[model samples]
Target: MSQADHRSPQDHEHTVHYDGPSGGWGSLRGIARIFGKEWATPAALETLARQNKPKGFMCVSCSWAKPADYHTFEFCENGAKATLWELTTLRCTPDFFAQHTVVELLTWNDYDLEQQGRLTHPLRYDPESDKYQPCSWEEAFHAIGAELRRLDPTSVIFYSSGRASLETSYLYALFARAYGNNNLPDSSNMCHETTSVALKKVIGAGVGTVVFDDLKNCDAMFFFGQNTGSNSPRFLHPLQDAAKRGVPIVTFNPVREKGLIAFTNPQNPAEMLTGSETPISTQYHQVRLGGDIAVMLGICKHVFAADDAAKAEGKRVLDVPFIEQHTQGFGDFEAKVRGTSWSEIEAKSGLSQGAIERAAEIYVKADRVIGVYGMGLTQHVHGFENVAMFVNMLLLKGNIGRDGTGISPVRGHSNVQGQRTVGISEKPELVPLDKIAEQFGFDPPRDKGMNTVEACEGILSGKVKAFFGLGGNFVRAIPEREAMERAWRKMDLTVQIATKLNRSHLVNGRTAYLLPCRGRTEQDMQASGPQAVSMEDTFSCIQGSIGLRKPASEHLKSEVDIVASLAEATLPPNPRLKWREWVDNYALIRDLIAQTYPDEFHDFNERMFTPGGFYRGNAARERIWKTTSGKAEFTVPDTLDAAGFDDAPGRYRLLTMRSNDQFNTTIYGFSDRLRGIEGTRQVLLMNPDDIAKAGLQEGQMVSLISDAQDGIHREAGPLKVTPFSLPAGCVGSYYPEMNPLMPLSHHDQQSKTPAAKSIAVRLKI
Candidate 1:
């Protein structure tokens, strides 16, 4: 465990180190720094102790689930940081906004804006004053309601972030429908929409089939496109344990992240003292950007070929019984896999045939396999296909319903899956409008609403008159910054329910309101006597969370209260669903949710308190496929070609990534400690040959220009080029900052998730 040479805050030098393992004494040092100074130790320790604990506040950083019987001190480095970030003592009061105008704040970076700290009260933008002033909850709600009522309900967009609790999200969705529209676009649309879209078509379930226990017992785990060590650090403990138990962990990613190579358990005293780290990734394949489908196809091709040869020698390699009994379209899928040539796979995937063959051999040898992936697999042009192909490969051996095998889309957001489960969606298929209408006594809107991309278009085109964000930095999170800013300016009304000030708050609409909400770690004192909210983990375990700390501010409202009050003020009176009652109890919200999704969330509150919460049973997990075909199906796209990056010479496939120090739009620091990047966030990782081919030198100032069809060439840079170990023709840049280069039109055809990974760009040196 080499020590990270972190320079003073004054240093602005671009430092890049090639080798460093994640989560050793390095993580411990980070934990000490975060909890020691800024957060002042005591409060930070209390919050950290509560995170992910049974009947405690859940960490809203990532959705990785801990097993029912978990270790006592269960948290990762990033988890600790997230806890401190939320539980910070700093306050962003009305005086803070008064000190800096919106225009002035816009000039500040995302980190600087958020570091101003927790919003102290609800505020309404006063154009005359040119500043945010404290506004009473009633006055703000009434004003927003009046504005919303003036606009067509269909013209309003309600966006939900994954941070909201299931209880809050259910009320949010109910509020949207009761207010006369179902235009609910959420954070999921940006990240895991492909997982939902693809899995539903293939396995009849939109989410993963495996639980935390399944992962622990899996013989082999295939991590595709997910950097678990950075994104979900606690997952490293399981991977290390699996390695210790002789279970092979295979990884396929374009960048060679040190987190995937080796991990030192910060929780273990012996490992930390001895500087011993567990080596993960028995096999690492640097598959090219947007080439996941081809690589998966190549692996399947090997499996089929190996099975044929083994059968010829009087041996069985494939699960023929499972394939015959529980799956459909295998013949067609097998034929297509066999048809793809090794040359095409080698060229497209940037992986030699031997690597893919070896991965397939590992897959074949394992009795029970778990497939895990993150945004890297789901943020591409072929994102849906990438997800489906993994399912197709797993279904070959009937891995769906078993002790340790199933699909796992490791979500980055804590309650992203929970948000969707409670009905935060733009599409109508997931929302049972009839049930909602009947249960709530209103004719819910039946039309499909705008997704995140479409919402931007709607706002820009003057179709969406009002945009309400129930927690998210929409401007920073979305692509086309200028266009989104312009669109936001065009909206008649904009409302953001947030914990702190972000770039989205600074980018105001014609009439903007910033409604401050309590952070996930804060206590909620409701009429029902200190209410507790529930959040479903990525594994669909709905666990209860009760905040142990005081509210950031006395004026801060629960998201449920904000949404309920806003709904009451906006919509016409409806007696059947008493908004106040729902807000007061929350258990009533669960009851309503049960009414809406009876089959899955039946006896809602009753089953919620059970030891580790209840798992929403997936039909696919039980090998009872609920698809139209009544069996698990293999669906292949027309072609697995990744064709955009080759439009011209010097064009490279750019993947937008988050620094280890950051979590989604929120920038924690300029340095990415594990990556050896210090004192800067403007560094771009590129291949050495690609840099030379583009006539660019290391640390050269460069602009990344995207190939645009709308006449406006999108570009973001003046970024320092840093050559690193990456596949040829592929480059990496930090996201949110690089989001401008990603066009709004560039998205998955099926899921409409912005193609954040496969951008074709040329360097402007």
Candidate 2:
């Protein structure tokens, strides 16, 4: 029976369609509501004005590249929310913790836990009393240090979030290695590890090659599995300008995202005065979930066929000479494309041959193209293959290593890319350990450290005894929530350096400490004077960020100070590495960074203050491939279906997504304004056809059961079914909430990123 047959007439009565453009009055209203709720003080307004400006702090939101040209206000709607969220007057003081026990706080949702407000002081979790008590910084550090000394460094996990500065990340990594291990698992493991893993092997650089100028001057821009509206709205401005200039902006995703369709720039007076919105995407293709690899194969097939025809007519299509000189494995890739059947391509991609040809035509005609993607292509079993295939498609036309061309992976956190560059990675080879050892007077650990998945597995099995987080809710962000939370308490020590209270603090271990630290929007005073820290954006531009406002709490220390002090407390004093001097003056840390990575950070301090920062300079842009073959390589996928899910009769491919009101695991609000969802987040979006096929009614309550081959039974319950425009076999739900359904083992074989985007599931009433 169809869902419509069982549905009542009032099922969609409360549903209100959002017909306006992405950034019109809707975004203004969103900004205003956040200000009004947070009681926007003059201080908050001043911080917002200074955001993304020269000599001011970067937005603590998405890692979109800053423009060379400055704007009157560079902050977006979500960026404003992130700033206000940090600048709020509400405080989660010791008294607040004293009133609510950890047991009681565990029942609260993620939004409520963070909404309780910023952490004001260092706190120690008392398991016997079931409450967090105020503790001196010295006491907290000494106890944490003692615990670290008692445990094996190999069993300790030092997890970092992308919100930290480059200097801080460098010191954090140094501390871990100094303590005798490289067990550094960070935020990148969850989102874009596939981009790093795939691109590094093929192009010799893990990060995107495109800069702001390349994106601005590109002849055409193609996006896959990215939602510019929610994740990084600042990118929409460039897309809006490109649309006005008649550039071809193409998008491929299951959901017709509002951001990719049209945008009304709130900063423009003319756009605000008129209700008109500039069209963003010239062509939008709703590619099936996990079908990106198949779609790429089909496009390549069409391109090869077109080139063959062109050769017969004495014309050229593919850049044959460029391919021969700059790339390897093209012949093998072409063979793989030709071997794939049209019927298989059509079935897997869920697109007709004509549609695939149209996309290929766009690629063939455009002289310079920039490819943009996000976690959607990276959070699957075959995620590494998905990224490699995209690069292969671009290589055919020589779309990389030229002006106005290259791949741009839209990073999530402000400094996520920078964190990796500064050496917050599990792989020791990615950084210059020999230089670090010489400069620091210690032999750094050469062994590969634990990534996020391995760290979680270690914790679950009671092998990892200590957890130290620099700035994130680690327990809540990773997969296997129930299992991790239960096992988390059994650990020996848990330490979180954060700006606010979170569910991670509530899920305390035997000995836990919550250390409050200064945020990006607040001034960080040191023994020297007002200081600035450097951060690298999505495009590898390393810029200085100096906070100008008073901190929310005077007791809060800078991340640099906290890390240095903790290192002092833990490790025996090393005369060669002056931890205190580094904290007192950040320039010392910058100097050491320059010494450690002479190639990348040479003259780091001098160029950091340059307007819009200086580019770190990607090797790939100069056609200097760092791969073993000394040239860019084309990779062939073993299978067209990346996820390799079974075609069971009652299964649907589920892709976890984020709401407009959320960033990573931080829930700003319950409303997802772009999709017209409000008041609650416990809802599932599915195609109307799929809803009918499942015999489910619109707004019907249902539970999702995982179809993973693992023996573990995982399920996420009581989600309201909402009919939406998705593929017949695909469904969408918010992430972290749906993270429970993802098993720890269900990750990419190469990158080990959680396969959150392509989980096979069955819905039950």
Candidate 3:
């Protein structure tokens, strides 16, 4: 392997500690640096100002809810980066591809590959020339259509990223089902599938129950596993606001995330001038990696014990009435919690009984509380149970279906939840397939479809023949990188619909096509007029995103248009579904969505652009349990060590994370300002004691080998070790880079989501 493949050299002489608060001058500088790097013009600034506005596009960086009351600058630092990156003038024209062959391009780093910029035309791979050549859109579509016609529908994987607008995602799902399969594995499969699966099973809703207003009114907030500083910076604003209001915000995460510690709101003039920072987390506990469930169990145990004491004093602590009326399985769940020993909790959680009880004390004191978490809680073998346990904690006091209290799984991509809302899932029961069949006049596939892991397996076994990527870098984002790369190339066809060049494009199949699509910030014009697409945020709010800037390339088409055109080419024209009309008029697509999911999308177009849009309305928020039990159920975990990782000596639970510069496999830069790491994504963050125990010094290069029992040896390195404030048995590294260390089979059996956050590994010098 080349040095670049394993090593990431430090830019600074030593790790630079950023002492300043999160999102003050540091954020401003970061924004400036990104804008300068992208060569963003004054027009880009004007366009950014419109982001998250009533009439503007949604920020593409995160799924954080946009407040109804918009600030002067609603977008955050990473949001600016996402917008500027999209608004960049650079173009990956045919000349650029001609200059570099597929093999040559494969040698380029992911950041450098995307830095080549927006794809301006439809391109097709030529095996003879070993380069991608420009081709007409019609030719590309025809080739894809012919390949699909030849292959069984079950063999075709229709993959989507969260970047696609709701209208586009809705259409993509329709097209895929019409072409005759439900192989709709999306970005959610890698991250928050656990949240959906667990939440749906317990509460009858797949999405978060809280709204933007909940943050403002919430008496106290409990955050687990999520890092707001890197993944969703906009959320820090509310956290800061809540802090200033004296709302106790308790956090339990392995890493001491700078965002949760404190924040300096750049938009606040008083704080900016005074150089003051608001302390966000009242109590921040660094739990062991994959130990959230244990910590949660301990908290619940403490709460139950407190309730027993309160009963003797004639003061009821638990919301007994609410629990009795709206929930079930409490008796069995409480028994399980009471049975779990504190010794096991401390051993597994890497936290003391005092720390766990302290958190419980805060939880019991609050009248209303919100439980917020991210992929840190979701990307595990028991990720589904992690979410269920969190919900159980909230349920102890009737936290759900009330103001200032609910569960919020902060999503990564801006429209990831919306994609699922509009019918993007491997499971047919999750979506309105029968309604779709009735509306579109086609029998939608009923068999369970392939998720990310299953799709990778299918590809490797030569069962999956075609890959239609709507927006994500699928090959890079998924686990088992080396295996997937080899399997991906063997596929019969791969169609990537994206705005810029990424690594997935270079990993070409036998027949490959790259169709350039318009970015979310660009004006999408069709036969009718200027068009707008809707996106659903983590808060379940459906809002319209209308592009304000000119198209990057005249040849570029909207995702809606592209999906429709591809559908028309692949499927025989259905009289009931007007593909041409839907593409021209996006409103018609929304109408179809409303007809299918009337409860959520009623009068979709009418309310789409209504100020901050409309809430799709989560049933769980209304205390309506859609589960088979007809009540919110409390789930009991099988064990404290949720992932069931063997307690082997010298073994470390590897937690893959994102740097402040990146957003879900898209590397923006080398620096992770919050972690004090600079110019390297390959450095592993470890506890000082653990580093010394392994006879490894800080900055020492080492290989991380997966401890999985699978026959295949999974290893990634020479990653530099950096001593930091992580737990003794845990280590942290950037994701996608560390994805190779996680075996594809190591995932949540219930949700099928890869346990990226809790891979078992050991260092090799």
Writing each residue's lDDT as its tens digit, candidate 2 over 1-765 gives 123321222234343335567998889888888887766577898888888877888889988876658789899999999999998888889899889999999899998898878889999999899999999999998999999999999999999998999999999999999998989989999999989999999999999999888867888888989999999999988898887887887778877778987789899998899877888887777888888999989988998998999999998789898899999999899999999999999888888888778777888788899999998899989999999999998898898999999998999999989999988999988989988888888999999999999999999999999999999889888999999999999999999999988888888889999999998888888889988998989989998998987887878999999999999999988998699999999998999888888888899888887787788889998999999999999998988887768668888899898988898899988878888888888988887777788888888999998888778888997999988767778888888889889889989999999988989888877
TM-score of each: 0.96, 0.97, 0.97
Residue range 1-765, candidate 3, lDDT tens digits: 123211122213343345667889888989999999998879998998899988898898898877778889999989999999999988889999889899999999899999988899999999999999999999988988888898889999999998898888888888888888889999999999999999999999988899888888988999998999988888988888888888988889887788987799999889888999877888888888878999999999999999999999998779999999999999999999989899999998988999899889989999989999998888888888899999999999999999999999999999998999888988998888888878988899898899988999999899999999998999899889998899889989999999889999989889999999999999988899999888988898888888979898999988988898898888987899799999889899889999989998898888987776798898899999999899999888987776658768978889898988999988889888987888988888877778788888888899999899777888998998887777778888988999898988899878989998899998888
Please report, in order, the local distance difference test score of every candidate based on alpha carbons. Answer: 0.84, 0.88, 0.88
| Count of backbone clashes, every candidate in sequence | 0, 0, 0
The list of candidate 1 runs beyond 4 A from truth reads: 1-15, 642-647
Off by over 4 Å in 2: 1-17
Model 2 clashes, total count: 0
Instruction: List the candidate 3 regions with Cα displacement exceeding 4 Å.
Output: 1-17
Q: What is the C-alpha lDDT profile of model 1 across 279-387, one tens digit per residue? A: 7888877888888888889988888888889899998778889999998898888888888899988877888898789889999889999999998888887788889
